[model samples]
Target: MTVRAAWLLPEGQTREDTRLAPVTPMAPESELRSRGGVIAGGDPLKATGAGLMQLRIGTGRAIVQGTDAQGAYPIAVTSPETLTVADGDPQHSRIDSVMLRIYDGLYDTSETTTATVEIVQGAAATTPVAPPLPPASLRLWDVTVPAGVSAGVGGLDWSNALADRRRYTTALGGIIPRGWGLAFDGAHDGQYRDDGAAGLQRWNSAAGAWLPYPYDSGWRPLALTAGYGNPGHGMPAAWRRLGSMVMLRGRIAPTKTGTTIANGATIATLPADIRPAGGKEFAWASPRDQTNKGPSVTRVEINVGGTLRIFESHDLPSWISLDGVTYCTD
Candidate 1:
């Protein structure tokens, strides 16, 4: 049996490996560019206590780009790496960024191809901004160092001082962690992400934004007004939302079976979020006579204020069907 490694050319081939070389790096690069960040489930450079001026990075793996012109590559911190934080300025506070960097000798002759973590110290000011990252680096976390901060005498506050900047990505276009500057283009349309407090979200190229996924509010019973209630049949007045469209179902009738329905009588009301922008009319099935013998068509109106009313009825309907009522909520 023979085994061939990635980026290996056929025997006796003299051509450069640029074509095949990019294949190996492009997978991670494309993923990182479109959905890259730290891979979940690993410690992935978690910051922990070491000393007042130092932090310990737990073992983890990440994918980061070198630059727009350079391909992305994977970096692993198999063992914990400890880094020292520079002492703060005496008069002004500053922010410092902890970054994971990939150094390629091909790009910079001065440096060898290696992955390492470093701290980029920010300038001191009344309001300090984090320092910009160098080429081919991924920001792990930001530390706020107050003025006069030093080791031993007064340790850095891990709670308020640390800001997590780590985002996450997955293979095969699975759910990734969303952060600022992540692209919402057609290439990533239909992909899902975790937007921190916003919960799960999906990219929509047409709407040009990330919308909440499964955009559904499971079926809820419609709020019936006075003189109206759900019929005794299995079907009951219910409403739900699917994406940008709101749907209604079930049957409604007067609380008293033989009572006549009034023109423009309010039957139920929709929730604010699922209400239609403008008035809509739907044809519904209703009982033709007091005996509930045959079906007849009736007009139902849903107003902008979310009021559901019977618009026109030939005679008193024992019950009205709302099974097919649907309208856009956008």
Candidate 2:
């Protein structure tokens, strides 16, 4: 056996001089960075229009496997490709598949090395299912044909009949597509993926799952009960969530200076979603008055049910500080 490497030609050699073999390995090398799928952008392999027993596939670029020895290759569809849909079974509904196929004459022993769109007709039975894809093929869409459907009679109901089977991939180190979630075997841990509707997600090897990106909820004003109001300062009673932790800040006072705040009086209620898993208590500083003598402390309780209350034995202070009050929501 002999070994052949590419691009070692001396100066004055044109690209054709290399027989394009040097460039052939480039695509497969880059394609291996990402799991095989359609490149994300511009309605790749999208179903543009449908008619009776027919479907049209829009322009797209996809990477798919070639022969095991040949590795992977890319297929580009510059123009719309129309495919014929098999007539539906008269007795039961059946699912058909639209596939993008590659045929390399050198390796596949075909007349020409080319890529084409083909339809794999499903079996008609009481419980019909989509046909399995052939070797060197990628499924672009799954089409459902109801019983007794035929050409030139009625068009397929695209909304209900077509299912998008196209997944996406990007340059190396970019967020992987949602469809390739299970394809990675914990080797790509710490990498991110675009989870479509769920937004961005990160792979966790330990948990063997994709976790949502951490986020912080901006501060929102806390709804104070009757008689309790902002202390007329810039800092108003507010709460926010930072990942699993919830933080509270601001100061609250009675609407009137002389208003009597009974012991264990409710100050405000926390939103149900940000409530703590268990009851929590915090010691907060309160303004000192003649009745309280010197600096005083107030006990603030945040119950599991989201009630925020204050406990004090002596007369209520002018204002209570809720700043520096933080707890874990979990």
Candidate 3:
């Protein structure tokens, strides 16, 4: 049914600054009786919520949804003005910042603050008269990747579908300070990527490896507790890593020789951080001969836990140099 035509202001809008638009009910003029500025709405001819209102918005138009003649209701903004938004001049303020977060089902969440552009209205690429973008460096262009929307509706503001803002921290979009950056406490494989100021490094949480770029600044060589649960000698195993490569060396005098030492005695334990990336075996060399003590030194294995095992040693006092390279982390 037809009701009194009046101006309606948008929600959250200030009463004074907000402008109300003229409206026309869908029913014919004679169907409903209008006196003064009020409308007497009824059934069959009025008061029904089936009627719509037509209004002119800019060079385009809009149709407002109907509601109870007594109660006010917002118009369902059906459709858009394809010719105006895509072909006419629109007003907007400059947005100084924007952020984008990408989430994969695997719990792999990452974000980028370097999003380089702001989306503005104007899609009339087919119009013979080309539309101009805002002056002074503002630009608009078509890209292969588009805002996620129905086909043919590219670059429409779909940012409302973005992830929750609370999930992201303030350190994003700023030159973050290390050691005090984020307080994740600790997480599985808690990875971090740093800028050149820290030398482009990442946390090798799985292996406990250090990071580097120019090398010297972020790396250090240290001594590992040589020997596993069994400590036979006071051997010191020194190790250092750069990138994925590891270098370790140590010397130990075995108490057992030959088959007696073949019990897989762990002579030196390396750090728990190195992984066997190169697949290279640990090598040992001794000056002892067949007549020395037990049997000649044979083979050894360096574990990721920094454990160095002497598979075969000859004499009780012969010194053997044990060394190997791995890409593992502790």
Candidate 4:
């Protein structure tokens, strides 16, 4: 199923209406814009293919059955252009709540005006077919609490999503609560959450949150130049990355200080840790001398493709152990 999010002009709404933006864009995706990016009033982006009549919403009637109370659902929209929730599995219960973003940007809720609509699932009648994303599994929710009774687990003050929609301890029932997502304390509150380029995740969606699947978020360790320093006590070396920044650190033995390396020579070959993106060049901090020599020893580093160059002040001064830290671009 595909849903749509829009900034509809209310019957009397104005540009200065002080209302919240209609659709909260997801993080790391639609936030920053480059030279070629979304501008105000830009048409919706293409789904999987090129231009298609993707976004559509209009007046719809909420189903009514007998005197249980005729509830009228207002303006239901699902399956935005960015995603599509398709049917799955046979036993999978044919109904549940789907995640969505209502307000795109920060705005005053007090100033915004709109009627509430209860979110329903599987076209308002869960009968097993056309259920949103599935793998053929049955989920039985324990929504047996009697009405008009101060109760245990109610889905929410809003949302008619079934009990299994939350974090369910049994059979992935996922009995998650409303207003909780991605960061719930429990083990599972939601279902498979797509991390864009990262991959997919499983959660309870309601009572639980998205499961933790830490990606190689750019902090990988790189083995330093092996045995490049003093023989048995080669300079202890380690390097790590964080986003666009790379940190390199190492220590040299006391006796081998000023006499360890050749003048104006490369101390070690760089690991992939600090290789600039696309092999492009980036400015990095100059290397330092930490032999407690104060002004007696000075060191500098130069990037030669993927090599580290070192220069010393005196070239042949006996000194204590030394430790240094330097940074580079990722």
Candidate 5:
């Protein structure tokens, strides 16, 4: 983490331009002018005088220090050699248009950019060494706190685990209380306007309430309909009410051992008492419609150990194992 490796020097400064040296603990302690030492009297072009040298240390990353006209060090005076620019030669030209540049290894060679620097004489005390930054750990998501932010809060980016696309449509309908039925439709809530019917509704978790969605013309919100048996029509009491969400908590399936059946094996002839635990294996005959689009189960086979085995049919051209897991096309 110390980024002291790169610096923004004036145009004329090269990697080894030699006007300064690396600031080491052994180097005599020179106070950075309240700003960096600066020389105001001479033309910046002709004078190698110091002022703007942007220093990159660590976290929250930029620093400015330099010398002034009177020379009473405002910014500490350091040997130029200590500053290192990334791609450009330390030997840079002193042209006004030139920018001192230094780059950390964050980018490839194609993106080299010059850094900007400002120098001041005795403008401030020695730049404070920043405290060590906690190493950043990348999680499934990264939250961002915009500028002018306060303590402990940031906007969340949940997209890392969320779907990118969603589709919707419109359905003209009336509200029904929970568990009620519709006149021409089906059973809604039992009472005329009791809760338990169906209509547009939202869950108000804090109040443990189910608020009715506005049905004014042109106003629509996401909705949940009743199961195939019940579709409540306009009974206000039957309006859909929010309820506790049901969460079916379960763990991933337990691991199972698999035995592959070799070619020419048959599984249909196995005894009905065959246990799946043993190494029984078999392959099935390829299906006739054979576009390889349909599923076919292998015949059950019995190994010497009394275990049951079944062949797995796979895609054509490759005959890879489809494994016994059931698949659905809907």
Candidate 6:
């Protein structure tokens, strides 16, 4: 399915009586000129070639059934010529949480004034159907904070503000709360391509460097998603895998010194031993790493000294074990 996001304006938001912008163009595709790039309004981005277009607002609602409560959505004025901003109109508006409705049971939500609608078409830049880059298998992590647990997972410290929508690159790390639980999907960033060896790269914050994730000291198979490649390990090695899923569970730490876990590990056992101490954040590592070989992992990650867990399996029929633990095959 295709997903799309937009900004919904109130009934009188565009009213002449109110100092708001009006739709300038009647054509379907509108033009917008921003500081960084140009956008065409109503020109929603397609994810797949034949997928249906769904709508979502800031991190809320999934487009299924009675999913989203009716509300206004914010949309980018694609065409400046089509949209007319009243002279000296207020730059921003603080309204209720944004919501979007696509079809019946297919939608997404956004927190910003507007929603980001990713239409599900055959294939577009927004929706590249080609196989995911390199590391095929991925692990999912669920972070939860328990009440009265003295510790709390620190918020993601995105170097840039949440408002800036650019290619964000930062060390991924956080704490797992002691009480409540939070679950989300995640994956490796890119293919494995180190200046020296064949393993994946690990961040060394103290030394300020990029060393290989210890995948067998000298061999590493680039992990894409889960269940796509032959599971194996070692450094200086590369395996072209597809994609898979992972689950993470733990308590939110009170501080930033996060926990580390290797990719391909079990998600259920995390909460017991990984709890934070003295307000330090949680750190995690993955058994997989991305290489210049294949698909690019985008969504989620965990970190610490940048050296979480490492893997070396090159090919395995089912989920295997490393560091003495069996993990689900991605």
> Per-residue lDDT of 1-330 in model 4, one digit per residue for the tens?
222222322455443332222322211111131011111121222112111211121221111111112111111222232322223223334433332222211232334433222222353233443234221111222121122212123222212222432221111222222311234333323334443344544444352445434312333333334434433454445565554556555543223433455555545566644655444322222234435444545454535467655555643322222244444463
Residue 45 C-alpha lDDT in model 3: 12
- Let me know the TM-score candidate 1 reaches against the reference structure: 0.62
Task: Report the C-alpha lDDT of model 2 over 31-146, residue by residue, as the tens digit.
Answer: 24324567767677788555776788887667666556666555566668788887788799988888877665566666555567878889887888889877667788888888
Local distance difference test values of all predictions, in order: 0.71, 0.70, 0.31, 0.32, 0.24, 0.23
Model 5, runs deviating above 4 Å: 1-19, 22-96, 107-330
Please report the candidate that would top TM-score against the real structure.
1
Ranking by TM-score, best first? 1, 2, 4, 3, 6, 5
The CA root-mean-square deviation of candidate 4, after full C-alpha superposition on the true structure, stands at 17.2
TM-score of each: 0.62, 0.57, 0.30, 0.32, 0.12, 0.15
Name the TM-score of candidate 2.
Answer: 0.57
Pick the lDDT winner: 1
- Kindly list the per-residue Cα lDDT of model 1 for residues 196-233, writing each as its tens digit: 77588777777777777777678998989988887687
Give candidate 6 misplaced runs (Cα > 4 Å): 1-46, 51-112, 118-197, 215-330
lDDT string for model 3 (214-317, tens) is: 23322333443332221255434456666556666555553434323334665655554454633335544555655646445566676545456655555433
Candidate 1 Cα misplacement greater than 4 A, ranges: 1-34, 178-186, 197-199, 216-240, 243-245, 248-330
Candidate 5 lowest-lDDT run of ten: 133-142
Off by over 4 Å in 2: 1-33, 66-70, 104-112, 177-187, 215-283, 286-330
Cα error, residue 36 of model 5, in Å, equals 6.5
Clashes of each: 2, 0, 19, 39, 81, 142
State residue 54's C-alpha deviation in candidate 4, in Å.
Answer: 34
